[model samples]
Target: MDLMAMIENAMTSPVIYLAILALATLDAFLPFLPSESVVIAAAVFAVSGIPSLPLIIVLAALGAFVGDHIGYLIGRLLRERRPGGRLIRAADRIAPHLHRRGGALIIAGRFVPGGRTAIVTASGATGYPLTRFTFFTAIAAVTWAGYSGLIGYLGGVAFESNSSLGLVVGLGLALSITALGELVRYVSRRRAAATGAG
Candidate 1:
């Protein structure tokens, strides 16, 4: 059997769900985790009936929620130990904005590499309440996972007959979507800054 077929065979129920979940959780603590890619891959596999879309979403969301909490806890611990540190300073600066727009920011941050980890961590460092953080993060994680999974599913459908085309298009679209989000965030921040300066 070819590599993909072999992989699909090995992608038993536990392997598929557990692997995605682990990666998703790890990415929360380490922004460089590439959990999004894995989720996309899982979605791609789901296209062939190798896995289930709902299962992928479930595992991804679970990992994201749990991982973010760990990151928050770590930030809280560090905050207690590090007086006037960078995290604390950043938290102070963003705390007001986060307080006013925590849910929106969390949702947007999920698409921005490194942004979610930093923001979530900072929130904890600044004593952002666990209850509020969980509420916002839970929502963000679900939305982010669903969006990513859909992207992969669509890409897989497009490449159903052409693997290379599907991969190229899938990756391209994913990157494009992320870029768009970043652009919007950049412009919004700039506009807000400009208004503040006025």
Candidate 2:
């Protein structure tokens, strides 16, 4: 069967929620998992009044939050293993800014493919504060889950006759959002560098 058919079949299973959770969790450490796509599919199904939207959001958010912590723990463990090094020093240089504007990074990363794992892993490796990281990541998790779901819901609703088109629109919008966020970050960094030089 095709992608939509497969998704529909998967939804029939009672443990689909568990699958979503597991995929989201693994996606935190392993960027290969298509958690975002699964989430969008689930949201699309929800729009068709098949599955519940809130459940998808909750599962996605919780999975994201816990996975981030797992990355943090991995970093903390690595920190314990090594002392001061060039890598640590470099991370330290960026730590303060990460702590200051970390929320934006976390939120933006959620939408970017392969970004969630990288951001959280880097944050942990650099020993960013657990409390602050948790606070910001939580917000990012909720926002990402909601925003992703909403995007899929809108697409599915708008293109009910052609799900393929809906999926394309949803994925396109997500990528566009990621691109815009990266652009903003790039501009902000350039402005900061210029100010520092001045």
* Cα lDDT of model 1 by residue, 28-104, tens digit: 77888778887887787678776898899988998999988988888898889996888788788898988888878
Worst 10 residues of 2 by lDDT: 82-91
> In model 2, which regions exceed 4 Å deviation?
84-90, 190-198
Clashes of each: 0, 0
TM-score of each: 0.89, 0.84
The most accurate candidate by TM-score is 1
Candidate 1 achieves a global lDDT of: 0.82
